[model samples]
Target: MGIGGGVFLGPVLLLIGFASPKNIAGICSAFVLVNSVVGLLSHSLQGRVDLSVLFFLGLVVFAGAQVGSFLGTRKFSPLLLQRIFAFILLAVSLKLGIGISG
Candidate 1:
């Protein structure tokens, strides 16, 4: 399911009586970390991982995540964050569907 698993997870958590948004967010973060590690290992075993590419991507992603977290904590509304995430998901889906590449 790749990262799209979040589309399932968030709703499932809500339906299962975890109505607290903060708890859901924590669960999602943990899920992401675990999934990322698993994905990385799987790709590495298949000789699909390029360390240099992964390093640069990881650095940029980490920096962006930190900035995003700061904004989320300090000023951004939850609705805004949700909309931003939705847009990102849409764009990713479009790119994949269209077989777009850099």
Candidate 2:
């Protein structure tokens, strides 16, 4: 599952079988939420939690999520969304591969 369970699980889940895009998103969101909470608690107890940065980043994430959620459900079709997700995964994989090799 790497460092974040959802990051690993999402693609694996998609590949293992077929599911609707809505179902994939919902499941991944729930998976990430649980993983995030566990990670947060672990860091917080170790006094690694940075409140100031977290607050600012949280706001930015919230804004982006508002637009993203709207667009994902209303603006883009499922096929387009899947293609975008694939592109993002490819980009991330390439970056990671390069970083590791370098």
Candidate 3:
């Protein structure tokens, strides 16, 4: 599945020391939109698309994206966002490393 360029691109930019949250979010959002559309089309062609699930998931994702876009572009200070992102990554890493049953 296409996880979208946004997922990796924004963090890579940050790691390379880019400090513009607005620019990063904007670029990533665009990439995610394109990737999502292409992915959905490909899945649909293979008869694996679920319209019912997509419809509800799409709504929630749209709302979350809207909020994230606003916060990332305006409310979140760059340092705070970076720290938060790092924490999330760490949490995920630990979770994967330790396994869910632990």
Candidate 4:
């Protein structure tokens, strides 16, 4: 299911009596990193990569991730983080469901 695994994983963890959100978050990050690298390598081998676009987007994402990691390390509310992740999952679901039809 590729990245869609997260959509299932978070809830399953919660349902299985895992109350620690931080552990889930850490696991998700590790999952993302491993999957993204695998995807990137596959795409690159298929000559689907545009290095310029990749560089620019990577720079933006890296900076944003640094800021987010910093904030996440601070004493913010866990509920707020969960709410934000839920919104992100919802948006991604909608986008994927609404494919362009010819």
CA lDDT, every model vs. true structure = 0.72, 0.78, 0.77, 0.76
Best by lDDT: 2
RMSD of each: 4.0, 2.6, 3.3, 3.2
Which residue ranges in model 1 land beyond 4 Å of their true spot? 15-19, 82-102
Q: What is the C-alpha local distance difference test score of candidate 4?
A: 0.76
- Best of the two (2, 3) by lDDT: 2
Give the C-alpha miss distance for residue 5 in model 3, angstroms: 4.7
Off by over 4 Å in 4: 1-4, 89-102
Sort the predicted structures by TM-score, highest score first.
2, 4, 3, 1
Sort by lDDT, top down from the best: 2, 3, 4, 1
| Candidate 3 C-alpha lDDT tens digits along 1-102 | 734555568788877868575676677678878888888899899999988798899899989988887888778897887687778667756776798724
Candidate 4, 1-102: lDDT as tens digits: 245376667767867967666677767777777778888899899999889799899999899878878777685588888787778777777877895311
Question: Which lDDT value does model 2 have at 34?
Answer: 81
Model 4 TM-score on a 0 to 1 scale: 0.74
Model 1: lDDT of residue 22: 46
TM value for model 1: 0.65
In model 3, how large is the Cα lDDT of residue 69? 77
Selected candidate, larger TM-score, 1 vs 2: 2
